[model samples]
Target: MLSYSEQEILAANVNPATGLATDYLNLFNEAIMLFEMGLDMPDMAEELADWHPRGYIEHFEKSGFELKDVVIAAYEHAPADIRGEFDAACERALTMFDTSIRVLMTANLEDPAAHADLSDRLRDMKGLVVEMDSHIHGRSPAQKSLQSEVDALF
Candidate 1:
C-alpha cells in the first residue's frame, strides 16, 4: 500500500491517479529531440551517440526534481496493471531509441532511404512515448480535469 495518500502524492507533483510523475517524460523528450535534429542535420548525428536510456526512477534520482522521493514511492505503489502497461511502453521506446542510434552510427544519412527509415523509426518511437504518456495521464476519460486541477496547484 502507498504510505502517502493520493492527495499527498498530488501535492508533490506526482499524478495521484496514475501514480506517475511527468518529469520522467522529459527524458524521453530529450531523446526524441536528438533524433529529430539528427534526421534534419547530418552533423547532429553525433549528438545521438551521447543519448542513453534512463529509467523513470533513475531519471528522478539523477534530476533535481524536489519531489523525487515522493514520486518514486508513488510509482512503486502504483497498481500492477497500470505499472505493467507503462513498463511495456517504456521498454519498447528504449529499444527503439537504441535501434535508431545504431542506424545513425552506421547508416549514410545522405541516402534518402536512410532518412525514410529514420523517419519511420521516429514516428514509431513517438507512438510509444504517447502510449507511455497515457499511463501517466491515468488512461481515464475523467483524468483530464483531475490532471488540470492538479496542475493548477503548482
Candidate 2:
C-alpha cells in the first residue's frame, strides 16, 4: 500500500511515450515502498532484497531538488495529526539517502572495509526507517517536539 505522496509521485513520473513510470522519482518511490513493506512484513524480504541502492542516488543526482525540501513540503501539506510522523520519516529518509550516496561513491565494493561501511550504513538506515514506520502507524507525543525542531531547520 503506497502512501498518498508516493502514489502522487508515481503518477507524476509517468513517461508519456511509455505510459509507465520509468522515471527516476518513480524508481525512488518504489524503493522506499519496498523498504517500508519489508519492515512491516518480513514475508516481502525476498522482494526487498533485490533493491539497488544506486537507483535512489541517481534520482537524487538527477532531480536537482534536495530531499529535505521535498520532505518539508510533504510535512507542511500533511494533516496535523500525521505531520509529526511525516516529519520523522522525512528526517530518516534523508539520512538514508545520504548513506546511499556514500555507498555509491565508494569505488571499491570488493574492499572489506568499504563493504563493511556500506553494510553498517544500510543496517542503520533500516533501523531508522523501522522507527519512522512506527511513528507513521501510530501517533506519538515525542513527534511534536521533533517536528518543531524540523520546522526550525527550514
Candidate 3:
C-alpha cells in the first residue's frame, strides 16, 4: 500500500473529476491514484479487474447497483457535454510527455556529481512506480503494460 504522503502527492497531481494533469509527471501520478483507489476498494477492484467494454456495458445494464457501479457507468457513458473531456485530457498528457522529454534533454549536465544524483532520483522514481503498479495489479497484463511504460520513462 502507498503511504499517506505518497497518496496525497499522487492525488494532488490531477483533477479527480476530469483526470487532467498539468504535466507529464502528473499524468502518471493520476494513473497511480486510479490504480490505488481501485485496489483499496473491493468492488472497485473487481470492476477494474474485469474491465472491458462488454463487462462494463453489462454492469451498466444491471439495475439497482452500488455507488461504485453507478460512478463507473457514468464515467463510461459521460454526459454529451463532457464526452470529449477525457479525449482532450489524453491529448494533453501526451503533449506533456513531449515536454518532459525536452526538459530532460536540455537539463544542466555540467556537474558529474549532480548527474549521479539525478540518476539516483530517477531510479528511485522508477522503483516507486513499479512498486505501486505491483501492489495494485499484481502480475496482470495491465501491470506489465504499466511497467513497460515506466521503464521507458526512466
What lDDT does each candidate get? 0.77, 0.44, 0.37
87, model 3: CA deviation in Å? 26
Clash-forming residue pairs, model 3: none
Best by lDDT: 1
> How close to the true structure is residue 44 of candidate 1, measured as C-alpha lDDT?
80
Name the weakest run of 10 consecutive residues (lDDT summed) in model 2: 14-23
Whole-model lDDT, candidate 1? 0.77
Candidate 3 has an lDDT of: 0.37
Q: Which is superior by lDDT, 1 or 3?
A: 1
**Pairwise lDDT winner, candidates 2 and 3:** 2
The superposed Cα distance between candidate 2 and the true structure at residue 44, in angstroms, equals 20
lDDT of each residue in 1-117, candidate 1, tens digit only:
788866778877787877887777777677777778888887787887877888888878888887788999999988889888888878888888888888876878889998889
Model 1: how far is 49 from its true place, Å?
2.0
Instruction: Sort by lDDT, best first.
Output: 1, 2, 3
TM-scores of all candidate predictions against the true structure: 0.83, 0.39, 0.27
Give a tens-digit lDDT track for model 2, residues 1-154: 2233564543444222222222333433455555444444545534644554443234445555534333333434545555555455556566585555444353255566765665565556544544444343343435545553332222
Candidate 2: TM-score? Answer: 0.39
